[model samples]
Target: MIKRQAREEDETHTAVQGCLRDLGKSLGYDVWIAANDRNRPLDGGKLGDGCLGELPAAVGQAPGADAVRLIDVLWLAKETGRIVAAFEVEHTTSIYSGIVRMLDLALGPEAHALEGMFLVAPDGREGEVKAQLARPAFSRIADLKVHYLPYGELKANREAIARFGEGMKPIQAIARNLV
Candidate 1:
């Protein structure tokens, strides 16, 4: 049972990876998610991953800041050959508060390399998330883009799934989606 559960978790992670890969292709960017180990926090500071760039320390206290703190995904735009954006996904449970904290991190220097930060949430929640982002501190991060992708939308988008399956090359079908 434990093995089976682990396998299922692996499968789910694969699917999410496939989706991101597809999204990258669709948007024309090279996508990467910061891994905890590879992008380990530096000097016990509130920063991680020298891959994108350096991030400075936080300025002020914010609610639910720590819980929502996680390196989300990073993306580099292929067309312009520049780091386009980095985003952190916040599920239903994490929601508004999580986005706020992510905005705090994204607005820092590391994210400045990108065109903007994306707040990816479950469907029907983009509006609220956007509203929260409208706060003065977050609004300073110019050109921020908010993308909301619901689970249902992902389920219905067969073309996207197919594209992802094809684009994530070298890996077999199962591994492509799983990895």
Candidate 2:
């Protein structure tokens, strides 16, 4: 039972990541999947291979390059290669680690404001997410503005989005602002 549950969680997480990757691509952004997840297939190819061959110069040179590289997904502007948004899917992993990844990018050497930074998780995890965000360790960085995007919301709206959505506005609308 435990193994089955674990497999289910992994599948859910991969599905969400794939949806986000497709959305990012459709919206004219360069998409990147986590380095470790590069082997997972999406859009008829390895997710990482479909992404920017090289990260934007800023992210690559950041002090927390390693952390940034592991971010669940990154959507970069095609023309300038600047990160337009970052997302960390906390399907069943530690939320704290996800937030740390966001912090790595936010406070890194080439620090630049991202239009959106999100924690994508199952809907029931909202309370867990809020409680973790309120922890003392995150107190100083409370202004980071990490939003919460529930799995239910994404799964429910993904098809409509892929068919008719234009840009990041559709996603920003569905994601609840954590602050």
Per-residue lDDT tens digits for candidate 1, residues 1-179, read 98998766544434543454455556555555444423333345322222333222221133332432344555565444344554555554445554554565555534555544454445666566656656665554345444444444555664645555433221112110100
> Which lDDT tens digits does candidate 2 get at residues 1-179?
99999988887787788889988988888998888887876657776666776687777876898899898998888887777789999998889888888898887754474788899999999998888888899974568778899999998998788788876788888999775
**Pairs clashing in candidate 1?**
14-177, 14-178
Query: By TM-score, how accurate is candidate 1?
Result: 0.45
Q: Give candidate 1 regions above 4 Å deviation.
A: 1-18, 25-29, 37-69, 77-82, 95-116, 141-143, 152-179
Full-model lDDT for every candidate? 0.45, 0.83
Total backbone collisions for each predicted model: 2, 0
